[model samples]
Target chain A: METLKINYKNLYFPPGGILMWIIIFLELITFGMALVVFAMYGSEEPEIFHQSRLQLNSTFGAINTVFLLTSGFFMANAVVEFKAKNVKKSSFYFKLTMLGGLLFLILKSVEYYHKIDSGITLETNTFFAFYWLLTGFHLIHVIMGLVILIWTNNGMMKKNSDTEVVDVEACAAFWHMCDLIWLLLFPVLYLIF
Target chain B: MKKTLLFNYGLLILLTISTAVISNFVAIKSLAIGLIMGLSALKFMLVSFEFMELKKANLFWKVSLIFVLFLIVLSVVFISN
Candidate 1:
């Protein structure tokens, strides 16, 4: 009888941890489903969708994209530095990541204020309904990511803290998930419509 | 690793600018939308593979991520058309 061997190196082990990846997948699916519904309605009311989309500031969306991507880059570096046992450098990168999250929230809030001032509300139309729901949900995720990053950073800052590498990696994974969600949202909301 | 990450970062920025230009300045609507979505997928891949370290992850995760992206993009494009 021949013995079968499993390739351990190629086997799937979720980055960060199993639970974190599960959460990531669930979030992605939720957003993806909402986007699909948005698209269906968009096709049904092309003119409305197009006009509503044009009212949005793509420039602001682009700027937010840059901010989130740069933040994600810094967060990734934080994980790398942590793995290399450079706790201070990792914490610095985490701070940068949080800054990026703050900037995104500020810009998004400004955009929302403009919409409200212009008399655009969730009840304004189908497009605006999605506009508020999708982006607002994502904003919540960003806030959560920032909180997690801060907690991870604080843990790292403590003297003789027993913060494990997995904890930091999990935070990084969550931050990157936020970036990924934004990547999907930006194009669907700001560009493609 | 650092050099590779830096290179990816530059690529992401370049892609972002290109997406903006294509979406805002391009006269052909279909072409612009197509390019924008394509660029978005590329950006997503870069972030997942590099920043998220999905490149080193299991085949199941990589495939699942790509599959979800495909579904979303396809649905949007299909509806728009």
Candidate 2:
């Protein structure tokens, strides 16, 4: 019998799984660098950072948490429905998840408006610096997730055969990752003070 | 399936309340943070395993993904201290 040959492309990197792992690893590196910066500056001027952390509105963080978690849940449901081939329900939850992301951005905007109006600029101190850096980074991920959701929704609307289960899974994972990062960040920033 | 779904949502609501309560009680500081984060981790696991159906995923993907996640969290805790 002829020796079996493995196709490199088919061997691994099943599109969705590979993409998910890549994103997770990237986030890990980002968080690592952030921690290193925190360690260095945190050693030099602990109080300033600690004090700035106190300025974070736990209420806003909590609301965003609820929205993102809800979004993640809906996205996961959409994935399940997609697997079951229940197109209508999948579309419904996809839209719901997008709505959740939209609400999160709006709440964030309102929170930012209040902060800027109150003149709590990043120049306030080291704490504000980290506060802006960390939350701002997380906000970027939130926006990215929203864009993915929109694209997925558009694909579904257009009746594309690209199989959106991967999109649903990736978006849900990203949203969940965002929430997980904040789970640590909130307590570190708000509750710690 | 419906029951599991209901239970999942209920647990989520309970976890939410626990997190909120823990946040407000800052006197405990580290303890409160640990407790809330701990609960959130539990919530995330539930969503991943139950809601996302990772339980049915292939062994390699399931174990490796979880391992990576644990490693990430462990690194964070270590670096943080």
Candidate 3:
């Protein structure tokens, strides 16, 4: 009997079924709870809460949104480059995507500085608490995406170039998911109740 | 491939801009939110199918992603309602 070994490049399709759904469902659940808590037990002072929301630099949120979208665009381009077998080009896009992530982090840090200087912390009120919690979760995902990009780019530059493409795509998939989640967060946290 | 790719990306940008604009300008915030969420869902599906190459993927993988997304979105709707 002859055993045919599939190429390492095609080893694992992204995971499916219970585990995958469970992870996404978990995120949805957390977001739902955030919404419900925000509605029911959120700050008693609607005026203050709304004012706090207005105080939020929508400009910064909008800027971060653009950065994440640009990063997602580059990641999508990297997938194209990977499929074209242009490893160098793929790495270039990955680096650009990571740079976008870094820029978003820096802008967020600056926003945090202004927020803290204005005497608003997570402990200030429910509005601030939710703001920090939701944005902080997003920041963590950006950081995770950055780490994935670095690892995948390093592998692409080394001996395991071909095998790295799938993981790279997976990282892009996750980053897109992060961006999608922030799409909802932006309106809910910034514009709506 | 290039045509569909451009179409999807173009639609994605349009949807993003529309979501922001509608949510910001409309007085009916909840309805605006629903629209934004809908548009974002559409954008997510396009990205997953077109950009991620899931259209040519195996059935199990495709269905799993679709199912997962549906469930997640359903949960959000259910909880929000």
Which candidate wins on lDDT?
Answer: 1
Scanning candidate 1 chain A in windows of ten residues, the lowest lDDT window is A1-10
lDDT of 2: 0.66
2 or 3: which has the higher DockQ? 3
> By DockQ thresholds, what CAPRI class is model 1?
medium
lDDT of 2 by residue, A60-99 (tens): 8877777877777777677667667777788898888889
lDDT per residue for candidate 1 within A1-193, as digits (tens), equals 1123323235445667778888998999999999889989998998999999999999999999999999999998998888788888988999999999999999999999999999999999999999999999999999999999889899888987788777887899998999999998999998887
Worst-scoring 10-residue span by lDDT in model 3 chain A: A1-10
Better model by DockQ: candidate 1 vs candidate 2: 1
Runs with alpha carbons beyond 4 Å of true place in candidate 1 = A1-12
Local error of candidate 1 at residue A85 (angstroms): 0.2
Clashing pairs in 3: none
Off by over 4 Å in 2: A1-15, A32-46, B1-6, B58-81
| Interface DockQ per candidate | 0.70, 0.29, 0.31
TM-score to true structure, per model: 0.95, 0.80, 0.79
Residue range B1-81, candidate 1, lDDT tens digits:
388888999999999999988987888877887788889989999999888888887888889889988888877777776
Worst 10 residues of 2 chain A by lDDT: A1-10
| Ranked candidates (lDDT, high to low) | 1, 3, 2
